[model samples]
Target: MKKKSLLVYGLSAMCLSFALPGPVAAVSNESCMECHSDDSLERDASTGHLASLFVDIEKFNASVHNFDEESCVGCHNAIEELDWDSDVPHPVDMPNPDCAECHDETVPAWAGSVHAEADITCYDCHNYHAPVQLAGRQTVAMMREAVWGKCHDAGASHDWLPQKEVHFRTGQCTVCHAPEDGSHVIFRLYDVTENRFLSCNEIMTGLQISGSFMANFDTDGDGVISPAEFQDFGEKLRERRFTTDIRAELN
Candidate 1:
């Protein structure tokens, strides 16, 4: 019985080679390192393709998705072409992988948060396909969302940082917050906090970008965590009292 099972497994592996290629060819990411071990392609675009290159593959492969799957692309439909310059043939209007595909309950949970009801779609967090882990969360979002989402168009429902809603309706929180790279995504506000966008910190903090928050609140020109600012920072993080005062505050 053992020999027969081995034969079946071998056949399955052989078949996996076609649907998958490179380190993605074998379930072992070491195989990927054997080829992509080089870092030349690491910083190609504002989009980070090399961030997860050093991740612990054992942990990834041990997950239920790796049992018979030979490649990660089977999951992240984006970048399947292996080219960042080329337009991704990603099918959906929102190419992000839906958590509901595997964990149906994920959507409803986030919907209850300040992001969803305001229509901050899944792409704001999970990113297109790069799954992430933040504050114990397995989010697929970009590294920048940590701060941008706070004063986003969604109002003060959720804040990775803190500021005010003075320009919340204008959908312009990037004036102060800036992503590390020229372009990286973060959640930000929109139509009365009922809608949002995933954009780069650079776009939000354009060279000519100016706002009252800077002159009124920023004691330091550094543009981040100015002490004079963020009085209701709690509101920016959805960490506020949520008291009856909140009903008045939202108004």
Candidate 2:
């Protein structure tokens, strides 16, 4: 009778082991990249648009969100694991990430903006993986590239503004358009050889700076670029044989 009881206990223990699920390994960015890296990877959205699922790993690495692999899952929580047998790993109705979760301060201001009123979402203008940082000229340039010709014609819409062409080139849309927002002047390097403004990336490459352009320029570490600092930065660029001019614009 004792031997029979031992056998029954062993059987129950075996059953319990089988019933419990083993730990699932946390999803890595590599796992997501396996499929998303494919340029042809696309899905049909409810709006009848073919939404591309392609993620450029290089650009993502360079982006501000390159902190960890979990960054992907942080935003896209629905994709828990990769199912090799299935064509679609995640649920079809997986919701978009709430931008307000991280951008609590910015979202409140954006919510009141004309873009929000027009049903423009953060995803509409901003790329999830390679989001453009809200620096002065770069931010304005990104906004212009995103909406111009697609949603707005600057020339036709801003006929009232003087030197509309120059404004479109040098000025930010938000300064005049978004009057509710405060304005600030940003000094940028204009490349005479390129006949265009030097991007942060270009400036960094030109100066051979290792970290942030702002950090390099803010000599006093005051979090604000003074007139002396701006002049010094321009001088450094000129020393590098870059035929550049400092252009200041309200943004």
Candidate 3:
């Protein structure tokens, strides 16, 4: 009877094992990087030109999307169905990923933007693998860096505007160029002595502020700097003997 009981237990265990789901084979970024990381990796394009397949792993890892959470298949879903053993691992033309999948809220705004009317795409200005995370003044800086020389000559194009260089430095391109988008004032601490903008770290050190610099200025805790708060901030800078002035620019 004990032998029969043991046999029944063994059969039940076997059935349980069969019922359990097996591990799915999911391709990771590392697997794609094995070949793509190689600088020599290139493929023949339909135009008879050699298109580079190389992906700078270091740059990609540093990008905002490199949280190790999303896989390469997340963007290139077609790659999952490809036969890796084949001589040509990639299709002749792999469609660009639908950025709206993640940026659903942003797509509608972008679609209505002046850039869309000009037929400019997200890929045109942005590098997918190593995109810059634009915040505050970074929006102006990135537009200047990416678009100024490559697409539009800012110096020559804005010749009609007096002190165009100063305007370009202090304001966002979209504020003037894409007026339909609207604009807001961004206050920055400028050092008259250095003739340059003071970074947040520099301001924190100069003011001897321990917590968030913005929070320190936003006295009413309203997230925005009121006129009273701005005046107080200027006083604090004066007290510290820091030759700094808060300059406002339309962004």
Candidate 4:
């Protein structure tokens, strides 16, 4: 049985290798890295743009999409010929990777977003070569900052909001602006009594005071504590007004 299991595992691994896209399935990343790894391989275009053809293998290996099973050509499949140990002219009009093929699920949502309406693509927020997967508050903050800078300038665009800075800082823009029926409502850290958002330090301190509170509020064990849960949590905080200082948003 053990020998049969081992044989099955080996076959599965071999099939996975064969299933990988592009010539990278056969050619290793080192084949392309020989020339691209050279920082000196730079060119000046007729349009006066200085194009650098260097690729830092160290950073590429550490990227979020980096896997031991794939090579550079896996994403850059347009390169039909490999000129090893010879200087080949870099294609200035080379096409970007077919990210939509792999990210079909997320592509639609992204295409519908306000950023997409303004002609922003995935590469704008997500670095292709060094993509970092962000989550939770960090992701919210990053997106907020990016959108604000690119389009919604507080002084020029959002000057009409009452307490604009406070409103922007207290909660994510999506909390109030995002289509209510579009996505799930995400509960955020707030201070009901103060009518302001709780700082990271305040949240951490509250957790230290009572670690079991989150588990109690999140009855379904889902990451989100729903509006009903928020009301319950608020009431509890109000009841223990002097003792507890943390609360979640109701809307």
Top-scoring candidate (lDDT) = 2
Instruction: Looking at model 2, report the run of 10 residues with the lowest lDDT sum.
Output: 132-141
User: Per-residue alpha-carbon lDDT of model 2 for 125-152, expressed as tens digits?
Assistant: 7787886445545444456775444667
| Cα lDDT computed for each candidate against the true fold | 0.43, 0.78, 0.76, 0.63
> RMSD to the native, candidate 4?
13.9
- Residue 18 lDDT in model 2? 98
Comparing 2 and 4 on TM-score, the stronger one = 2
Task: Please write out the lDDT profile of model 3 over residues 138-240, one tens digit for every residue.
Answer: 4444577854457777777778876676776777866656656677777798889989999888889888878897778886788877768878988888899
Question: By the TM-score metric, which is better: model 1 or model 3?
Answer: 3
Q: How do the residues 55-168 of candidate 4 rate in per-residue lDDT, one tens digit apiece?
A: 777777877667544456667777655655355633446677867877898888778888789887876566566565445543234656543356445545667665566555
Error of 3 at 125 (Å): 1.6
Model 1: per-residue lDDT, tens digit, 122-161? 7555433224334422121223354345443443343553
Q: How many backbone clashes can be found in candidate 1? A: 12
